[model samples]
Every structure is written in C-alpha cells, then in structure tokens.
Target: MKNLKESLKRRFSESNGGNEVRSPLRVLLRKEVAEHIRSWRFIILLTLIVLTFIASMYSSLSNIKSAFVATDNSSTSFFYLKLLTLTDDSIPAFHIFLSFLAPILGISLGFDAVNSENNNGSLIRLMAQPLYRDNLILAKFLAPLLIVAILFFSLTFLIVGYAMCISGIPIEWQEVVRILAFNGMTVLYVGFWLSIAVLLSIRFRQPATSALTAIGIWLFFTVFFQVVINIAIKAFIPDPNYLSADKIAYYNEVILNILRISPSQLYVDASTTLLMPMVRSLGPVSMEQMAGAIPSSISLRNSLMLVWPQLSGLIAFTLLLFAVSYALFMRREIRS
Candidate 1:
C-alpha cells in the first residue's frame, strides 16, 4: 500500500510538471461519486425511487382529468403542479413517497461512508497522500449530495415531461418555479438524513453498527417520534371537550411547535407549502384571521415566504450534523 501510494503521488507530480498541482479534493470527490454510482445499494435505492415515481405518476394521471374538471369552475390555477401532489388513495403523491424513500436513499449512501474505508484499511493510506482530512470529509458529504441533487432534478423533469404529455398543458412559469423549489427543498431534507448517517459512520467503528444506528434514528423520527408526540399531547391536554377555546388553541400551538422539532415534519410542511399554492398557513388560523382573506392561490413568492422558516430549519440542522461530523473526523487519530 505504501509503494502504491508513493507511485500514485509520483505519477501525479510528474503529470503536473511545473504547473499547479491538481486538487486532491477534486480527485477524491470524483472517486466517491463514482463508487456511489456503481454500488449495488445505490442501484437498489435508485430503482426503488424510480418505481415509486412511476407509481405516483400513474396514480396522479388517473385522477388528473377529474381534478381538472372539478377545478374548471374554480379560480384556482397551477394545475400543472397537481401532477406531483395529486394521486389516488392507493398510492401516495410523488412528494409523499419521496419524503419516505429519500431518507433511506441518503442513509444507504452515507451510513458506511467513513467506517467502511476505515474497516478496509484504506483511510490511513489515503490520509498518507497529499489529501487534507477536511477535503476527504467534505468530499464524502458533497459527493452523495451532488448525486442526490442530480437524481431529484432528473426525476422532477421526468415528472414534468410525463405530465405535459398526458395533460396537454404547458407548465406555467410559476408552476415551474414551485416544482424547482420543491425539488431543492427535498434535496436539503435528504441531505439532513445523509449528514446524520455520515455522523454515525464517523462515530462508530463498524459499518454495520453505524448503518443500524442511522436506520434506528430514521425510524425514530418517521414512526415512533410522532406516536410519542401524540401521547405527550394527550397526556397534557387529557380532555379537549372541557377545555376552553383559548386553552385548546394553546395546546394546539404547543403540539405544532413540538412536532416541528422532527425533521420529517419540517420537510412535509415545506414541501406541502411549495407544491400546493393554496396552502397559505402552516399553523392554525383563527376565524378572524381568515374572515376577510380572499380565497385565492398564493403567488410563488408567498409560498416561498411561508416555507422559509421550515427551509431554514432544515438547513440549520443539516449543517449542524455535518459540522459535528467534520469536527469529530478531523480530530480523531487515524491508524493503519
């Protein structure tokens, strides 16, 4: 391994000649991306996402005609956006399916990111090269992130094209913007999970341990967390029947604030607001607040404004995890 590293370093130095040396970061990033693309786990996850996309699109198309007819008399617009949010009862909409599957895709890509290299005894050898630890860790996160963005954008365009063919409606600029924004938010949401997985990978020595821990975290947020929240809410409220309106409102607010602590809830709120223009509020709206409001779809600006807090939260949490992972990975001793 030492000889191989020396030879590779020499080759790179010779190739660079007197010019600036090539960036090891770029080489590592490309290698990470290629490995992710060629991995069987990635292939399986990609196939699952594609299948779900197809199922959701099929369900959306089946209901889209009726949706159009039903909304014909209404002043609502952005029908093109419905291709993503609309679906039958049997299959969830694209965004809903994505929320569930995207996290798994992220976890699969990153749960073994660092630990697997360490287990295979390549990490110390890589560190022996010209690469900085910062570059290596950053490349690990960025490569999966880039691949995720590409996958999501491609799927979004595919949905758009399929919708256009079936609905015979050119997508409005507003609709295009909204769809793009949703895709971007989804990427961030997945990145949050990816960061968590990466952190676990760095923290645990075994890839299997990190992978299981990451999945356990996902399951906690996706399933058990909500249940615990509901139980806690019930324990607090006890009986809403006897509670005053003000008390009920207070508890409702508390519940929402608690739910927002979960990343999944944040993603859902942001995605829903972006994909559905009619969603004007993420929280409870008093009758007084809605009394004089016009019944109209909000503009793209308003939709973005509505989701900005959630989007910001997702960004903050993702960064926090990655930063923790980076700090830990950088400070740790690497031994062969």
Candidate 2:
C-alpha cells in the first residue's frame, strides 16, 4: 500500500515538474502552417496555380513559335513582332495574370478561417491551451501569406525554367530579380484581401455568411465601385482639359489616394507604375525634333517610393482588421 501511494505521488510530481512550456507563438505558427498544408484547400490552390502557369506558358510559347515562323506579310509580322516583344517583358505579363487570380485565392484561404475553426470545435480547445489568444489570429493570417509567397516563387521558377528550355534564351539577372520582386508585391497585395476575409470570418460565426460577405466585397471592388467611380468622375468633371498641369497632377494624386481605399485598385496602379515606364507628354515646351517628351522613365526606386503610400495603407488596414478580429475572438464566450 505504501509503495503504491509513493509511486502515485512520484508520478504526479514528475508530470507537474516536466510540464515543458513551449513558446506559444512558435507552436501556433508551425501547427497552423502544417495544418494549412495538409488541408485539401491548400493542395487544390497550389495545384491550380501550377496548372494555370503551365497552361499559360504552353499557350504563350506556341504563340511565340508561330510569330517567329510567320510569312513575309505586313499585318502578320507587325502583330507578331509586338507579341514577341511583350513576351520578352514576362514580368508585366505575369502581373496582369496574377492581378485577377491572387484575390480569389486569398479570399478562399481566409473566408472560413475563424468560422470553420468554431464549427469544428477547435477554437475552444485551442483556447484551452496555454497559448495567447492573439496567437491564433496571427497564425491564421501568416499561414496564408506564407503559402502565397511559396506558390509565387515556385511558379516563377517553373516559368523561368520552361522559358530557358524551350526558347533557348538566357535569363538576365535583372529580369529574374525584377520578376521576383514583382511577385513578392503581388503576394502582399493578396495578403491584404486575406486579412480582410479573415476579419469577416471572425465577425460572422456562420461560414456561408462569411464567404458571401467576402465575395460581395470582392465584387464591389472589382466591378461595382469602379463603375460608380467612373460615372462620378465623368459626371463631375465634364471638361477634362480645364485642369492645368499642376492641377492635373494634384487631381491624379487625389484619385490615387481615393482608390487606395480598395486594395485591388491600389495594387493595379502600383503595378502599372512598377512594370511600365512613364510616357510623359511634350506639353508646351515640345521639342519639334523629338517625337515625344517621354520625360525620363521613373527609376525603380521612385516607383517603390510612389507605392509607399499604398503599401503603408494596406499594412495599416491589415493591422486594424486583425486587431479587431483578435479583440473579438479574445472577448467572445466559447461554450464547449
């Protein structure tokens, strides 16, 4: 009897003493990222990105081949030359493709983030652990961001490899780095939507409602609001040329600032600035000898600076939305 009691006491003491305290942040991040990778949604998302990239490359390369083999025809050669040149600027082309697809992926990953956890009864159990409440929100936000980055870089590598093997064109270091940086910006731009979707997920307990809300917001930015803005601009500013150079510049700045309200638009404009050189008008000081003023294209540094306001806006909005979600999750009563 004494031995049994002593053994039981020793076991209890050892269990208490060996309660290894792992860093909640590290534990949550790893668990969340691993769970995301294991989910069918992540697999499907990655597969879609890979398959789409492959399809695009096949189609683009076929077009390039046809362009090179075209007969000595005026329209054929003209169009083919433009097409071939555009292919050389693949980074911009990739941006155009990602502009549409990235938001959908972002929304998909985040729309059900919180509600699904609640439905699965995981949220309550997760909270029961010695983890900070904020950890869950941070994990949810970061896992998708990491996935976005990984898929982007993977697609870039695949594209570069295919281009090299098929076209026999050497990859320039600058082109590779530029494309990589452009892809990174796109991931962050997509992260903004993910953050918004996560905020909605936390706000609504029903998964369907959260998903619908996210779609509605997506449509508003992509279609509805843009139409409204166009109409408003046309109606209010009937005479576009009445504005002077300084006024036009100021107006452009204002318009960009307003559009930054929607991350999608902000991203598109920032991308345009990044990918294309500015084609400035000659204006009154028009040099008769010169075709166009084309006031020196903005440097990459200037482009990055121009995007700063939008980037900062996105970061601020993401932080604010996340803060709200975290606060709500922490304060809510999770009844098991």
Query: TM-scores of all models?
Result: 0.93, 0.76
Q: What tens-digit string does per-residue lDDT give for candidate 2 at 214-268?
A: 8898889888886788677777664757867666655555665566678787777
Best by lDDT: 1
Q: Candidate 2: lDDT over CA atoms? A: 0.68
Instruction: Report clash pairs, candidate 1.
Output: none
List, residue by residue over 69-89, the lDDT tens digit for candidate 1.
755766865777766787778
Q: lDDT scores for all predictions?
A: 0.85, 0.68
TM-score of 2: 0.76
Model 2: which residue pairs collide?
none
